[model samples]
Target: MTPPEHGILGRVAGAVTGKVVDAVPVEEILEHVDLDAVLDQVDVNHLLDRIDVNRFLDRVDLDRLLARADVNALLAGVDLEDLVQRAGIPDVVASTTGDLLGRTLDVARRQVVGLDAVVTGLVDRLLRRRGPAPLGPVLLVGER
Candidate 1:
């Protein structure tokens, strides 16, 4: 992944960290350089403008669909317990269950990254296609 690709991950990591770091010195670091602020400053829509949607979807990880014993058993027409025993709680195929789980999670993460890229592309396309629109309505008025 390139620097721009990291933007999506950075935004997610920052938001997750921010919730727990509000009172820490990290706030000072954020004041100096905030991921969300940086994301806002950039036109993410611009980055997504050129991607092919079909190709993007093809890159998504589908292994997670069978990562669960129940799901795998159902798909393969076997009993869940039998499947579990065959692929034990601590083993999947030949590797440790934890290793299999980790790989599955890695695939899921990559899928998420692919999805984010597609979304960013779609946003860029829409922004470019629509040009600019009037910001006229303030539906819910809030007190300052």
Candidate 2:
């Protein structure tokens, strides 16, 4: 088959297979094949045949979906004042708290090989410390 034809077939197969996978119970999917095998082998065209496209499309609201995404919520929670404080540092320093932490780790690794850069770096980091707000905790949730 031509490359274009192959690509189209792949997309169709993916859509159908995805639907089939979603509709099938998790236990039944495992009975047929492991998760990876089922994901790799299921044909999307077969899935499409068993599901209603119009109904599926009707159930999806693109705007509402994007609004519910975690990244958007995180961005909304960002405090401008906290960001401004974090951005300021002593003139001699060339790093943020995260950058200093990474640099300190690198220095420690080098020290293990008889090369030390920790003392000066630590002093610089201390001098550059800006009282920034505490970052909020991240919560991870599994699907029910």
Candidate 3:
């Protein structure tokens, strides 16, 4: 190839090129550029392979990020039952609930049985019927 141009002609050419470059608006230049053709020349996967995710995370300000976060939005996104199960609370809740339910049913059953016997006795006396008009069903008595 020819030797590098020097002297007055090269300096004039360089000055004119610099002026033209300075005059072109970057946005107009970008509009004229073939962006798809430029992107096709890039190696996206190779660029991504060079990133250190752990090191990147280490540099992140998690406390600051959390401070800026919408607590209500985050709560809305969460599954409370899943979170409770993950924290190992479901077994305790289930056992406590089961015990509470058993106690409640026992109290209710006793109340109903007592009320039923009282009503039966009152009806038996009014009709002048036999001893105890049976509390609940007579199914068990006949079976015996």
Q: Against the true structure, whose TM-score is highest?
A: 3
Model with the higher TM-score, candidate 1 or 2: 1
Q: Candidate 1, which ten residues in sequence have the lowest lDDT sum?
A: 129-138
Instruction: Give the C-alpha miss distance for residue 74 in model 1, angstroms.
Output: 38
- Number of colliding residue pairs in each model: 2, 5, 0
TM-score of each: 0.25, 0.21, 0.40
lDDT by residue (tens digit), candidate 2, 1-144: 235766988878888888988999878877866678768888988988999889999999989998878996677989877776687744325557668889999988877644333554565578885554223224444322
Candidate 1 — what's its lDDT? 0.71
Summarize candidate 3's per-residue lDDT along 17-120 as a digit string, tens digits. 78877999778878988999999999999999999999999999999998999989879989998999899898898999999999999999999988987887
Which ten-residue region of model 3 has the weakest summed lDDT? 135-144
Instruction: Output the lDDT of residue 39, model 1.
Output: 87
Candidate ranking under lDDT, highest first, comes to: 3, 1, 2
**Which residues of candidate 1, in runs, are more than 4 Å off?**
1-95, 129-144
Which pairs in model 2 have colliding backbones? 13-44, 16-44, 16-47, 16-48, 17-44
* lDDT, model 2, position 3: 55
**Model 1 lDDT tens row, 28-51:** 766877688788888778878877
User: Which 10 consecutive positions of candidate 2 have the poorest summed lDDT?
Assistant: 133-142
